[model samples]
Target: MASESSSSSSSSPASPASSSSFLTEPSPPHSPSLDATTSSNIDIPVLISGAGPTGLMAGLLLAKMGIRSRIIERDMAPTPDSRAVGTHARTIEILKLTDKAVYEEVGSQSWRSESMRFYFGNSLVADIKPKPSNDSEFHVPWMLAQTETVKILTDAYEKTGMGKVERGWELLDTKVVEQEQEQVEHQQAEDGTTQDVKTTTRTTSWVETTMRRAIEGTNKRKGESVVLGTVDMAGEDEDKDYEVKVVRSEYLIASDGGRSTVRHRLNIPFPGRTRDYNFILFDGHVETDLSTSHITFINGDNRHSVGMFPIRDNRVRMMLDDGTLTQEQFNAREPKTPTKEYFEKLLEETLGTLKLKVLSYNWLTYYRVNERRAAEFTHKRRIFLAGDSAHCHSPAGGQGMNTGLQDSYNLAWKIALVLNGTAPQSLLDSYNEERIPIADEIIKFSAKTLDNGVYQGWLSSNMKRMMLSIVPFLVRYLPNGRSRPPFSMLGLRYHENSVNKAHKSQHYPVTGPASIGQRAPDDILVPFTAPADTSVPRSEYLAELEEDLTDQPIPTRLYELLAFPGVFHILVFAADRLAKEKDFDCCLVKDVDHYQRIWSSRWPGLRGVLESNATSEAMMCKKMKSTPQFMVHVISSATPSSFESDPNETTTTALADREAGFGKVYIDCEGGRLHERYGFAGVSTKKAGGGIVVLRPDTHIGFRVSNVESAAWVEVDEYFGSILVN
Candidate 1:
């Protein structure tokens, strides 16, 4: 086999490969971009294989956390077809929280689908809509083409100044290696000359990946550079040869679709089964008598069903189950054109009396439903499997792409923390512990949905019809009618782990609307007066607040404060009863001093390196580049009038003067909404008394304590201590 070494770093050579027939010695010269000092060498912190939504999202999250990553896509150009079109609510929340611009672009360009209508034999049965939740603003899915989603993420990632996706590059293999390396630093002397005066030896482990240029040239359309879309059918060059290269990186994330090369190369068994059912999906312009505003499902004779999803401007995606043959027979059949006549006939059979005319088409394909998952999400703690690489199942609920996007979101922050020395290497283990279970649940959920709705038998068909008949009523009146499983994905949560845990205090139980590992609910809050305006009398400021609240800086949402990247949001709720008690300072802002130190400590440079005995100021400067980890916010149950003239001047001393641990502080102005949502309203009356909640970087509740006293502060410190490093 022909291969090329990308790195000239003789000190840190590519790790030895596992015994495989594909392994071979270097043959071709290295590509200029892959050389040691350039793209693929030790300087790169992360190497992501697959530029699909998952891989692109991973790169974006890393960039948001102030870490740089390289993404390589095997395909030279994007496919014209929109493969996965349903971007779910939870995925929207993740995008909005991490990058608002990307979220806004998607919201504006995509179709927002909040309701779905189901019919049986031309008779409408159920019209279902998701219930809105106080925890998130998004309760509907965004129906955008996968191609468009990739373009948006690509644009946002490129704008970060990190770099663009390296298209046509394919990963062949990977192996983990450990070695001691020398880090050389050049310092300017008094003579105005640079000298390599500092050299440090550090032991590090990295994944050495073998990659190659599988294709060449950008896929352009009509002489315009195509940022994304399907491969150009007219640009075929079968005679071109390929070049191979090997590069070393600290971490490797595999998101290379269901048939992942990285998964196969590692010999990881994808244990699962493929069902006999076959599905035909096509996107096209269509004219129909049916309502095209929301997703619609029609069931006809022989248990056959078809789903229609609106794609903007008269375009609709049609999916139908083809029972003409088993999956095996369908796969073995001779190739046939998916002509308009053929699809029209298929829809006529599935739609019964309903009529639809296929005017034109862009893409069409067929596939068998396969349920599979890797045995391990991570290998050797250096290589990770994400998206379809880790697990895949039926696309019945339009959850495939959304699940993959979340997988990257879950893993990115942990990797960033570990790489930046903010968290221990052990922190990475939580990725598998948390995401694998979610993957398994999604797999089971989608499989059941496919069976009940599309590929149903006689018994299941009757049961599904009965269920569909009552769905409208249940959805309208039921308490949990809003966010259903596998749709909103709001209920997905991690179990207690190193980063997600309950308090060690035995005196009281941590009670809240959401558990320790669930999503933190969102609520409105009134911002504290600006430092300059804090001296204004309470009566004077109240009038300004009433007129043009926006100009006076109106209320803020809980998520708005939590959106800061890679930082733990500590919500300190000062309950009303506790605030009215004697020594209210002790109950409210007593531990603000301790939190300030912990918050400032996140930046290693500002704190002077907690464990550093650096020889010079330059050495100290390097450590200061570390990213901050925690942001503390104080929410009080007291009124806006309690601030100015109070004897303690708690708001002035703790908030306006010190910045409240360098984070925002707000008041629960809306009839104790924030307090009740966090289960802190009655906390003062409880045996243990509690009001502290810690939200992880991903917005899930990581930890909570019963009180904000000195002891509770210790518990909070220990919670962070479990995952973060000094």
Candidate 2:
């Protein structure tokens, strides 16, 4: 389980070979039965190659979607290197919805900052800070190393009970093969006897992968948990040879980093330019006069920019251009900057009068930056290239890993629905349609940033300084003024994706300016429900309800319900009680009836509807997760005691109770804060204020349905019908 055990010989060539000999040998402490490597030729619906942050993320997401996958990594242990350090806010929100605990787990070790400090050769240029107020408490991006991010995702995937990552295994080759499977069915006869009645056979295309691993399988990979009866390969080895194994899967996702062997074999063209400068990248402890509280950049005449960002344990990640030789000298088979003295020279030059020194290093390397992307992300709709395999760029602002994380998020659910018969094959096309453009944009922006960062000119440097000086003032005083959206990733949207109806150019009028094809905005909700039996004013008990906080179940937030996995969320903003008429609304139950018919007509096997307003007596018992494909939540203007009692019927009249809250209950609150936010402030209460918001699994608002029973809902059917299975 030690990191050293799985390190590549290329990574630490000076180390003794005997040190890794034990990697293939079995330890005495482990039982021989546990030590034996069992191989089975099994068919998997989804297979992922590479177990880095991207691959691990894809596996975790698929598991949450109720699909199983096998993840493979070439290395025998986890690496300690950290390529990504900034986890952006958009990624944070995405993680929150994927697994509620992941956001906090990674957040605990991550550092957050609202501003950054800049110095031009020891002289302060300006402090660039974002204007505060109004987003979530955890609005800022967190700095966590990529290794730690991988650990968190891997742990979460293991706990899902769907699949495991096969470490110490390499994907040697993959071939498309046609496979046949025979299925059996049984029926009961009228004689009260069971009959083995029917049989069906089918042939399908599968990707057969040839995998290799050490035959003896020496040590368990780092962060590996104890599987009830598995061997911990942590001791010495008697064998050095490897064993070849084969596994079959319907689809293959290649997330094998920038230098992908899969991409190599496929002969895919990785088009882009590689930079000439050799840059020193390191993570280590430093002794410096500059503060480490925020992102600090050392600039010198725009020709040299050295980035220094603080990390955990008082360590820092430093990057500086290695300018010792000419471009021609380096191209003539010259060695990269080898000595630690070169790094010291960089620090001395950038820091100028300030005292800054690197005392020790966790990792250090010199490399040329490559800005490249694969020409295509898919092959035959069965193979996918994700993360580094799809695109690569300078690690400016740590955008590489963050972009890759989004790549997986964009693909997982679409594939999951397809494999399990919940969606159609056509849905998969949107992956390339949507993500490739984002990848293209990130590449363009990162490449430009790198170029402009080193731009040397009379007008540019002075302009940059002037802009930085005034940013804080504008951010502080301007109304609705704040940091740019790109940094927070809130600006990311599918401008013209096949699945999203609205173009990115269109603007949404809702509060938060929520837009279609963009991340859905969040809002608060006040829980509400009228007593099942009587029409009584809530003011009579409203004060008592607030006094005993635990006794009264207050309203929940919009994000809370979206966290429930694998369903489309429909938010119905029902009309509250009429001011003068003072009658409770009936549109909610009617909307429920509309959904019931839709479910019965098209989706009998799927659970999708969650009604928050008036629940029929038959459906008040099913749990949220068990409710299949649709979730319905209501926001009404009425309170618990505002309904008329129905004494004639035996149905329970218990609103606001736990059972009544199955789909969740919410009140519009005094002055109708939420009602106004969704554009239903003052309206006739004679019927439901009919509107349905369709939210995707990723929480992007796909489109809106104006009427639950009109042809608009039929468009909803056509939408899902286009992607979802019949």
Q: What is the TM-score of each candidate against the true structure?
A: 0.82, 0.77
On a 0 to 1 TM-score scale, where does candidate 2 land against the true structure? Answer: 0.77
lDDT of 2 by residue, 1-726 (tens): 111123333221111223323232221211111011111223576789999888998988888777788998977777787668888877887787788667779988898865678777668877777554233323567887888899899998888887798897766566555434444567888998888855544444546565556555533344442211112233323335555555666678999788765676566788987777667788888877777767887776426778877777667887786654455666574444346776787667766787777889877777567788899888656778899889998877578888888888888877766665566667778888888888888888887776655535658877777787776677677553134445667667775456776522233453334456666655545544333444444454454333322343434456666664456776665554422132223333544546656754564433322222112332233344344466666555544345333444232222244332233455555545455544455744544444556677777777665443344455666666655666
Regions of model 2 farther than 4 Å from truth: 1-42, 132-137, 178-203, 216-240, 323-329, 478-484, 502-512, 529-537, 542-556, 575-584, 600-627, 636-663, 667-690, 707-715
lDDT at position 590, candidate 1: 55
Q: Which lDDT tens digits does candidate 1 get at residues 1-726?
A: 122254222222222242223344322222212101112235367889989999999988888777788898877766677778788878988887778788889999899777898988888888887676545667778898898999999888888776479887767677776544456778999999998965644544556687756334522224322221222324433444445566666789999888776887788998988878766788888898987779999887746789899878878888887764675586477654355666678779888888888888887766577899999999877889999889888878888889999999889888877776667778888899999899898999998878777745678777887888887676667553234545778778888788888766433333435677777777656666543565676556644543322342435566766554566778888665333555655434557666657646653411111221112121112332433466677776655554444533534424533332244456675546678777676554333454788998888888887677777878887777677775
- Provide the lowest-lDDT 10-residue window in model 1: 605-614
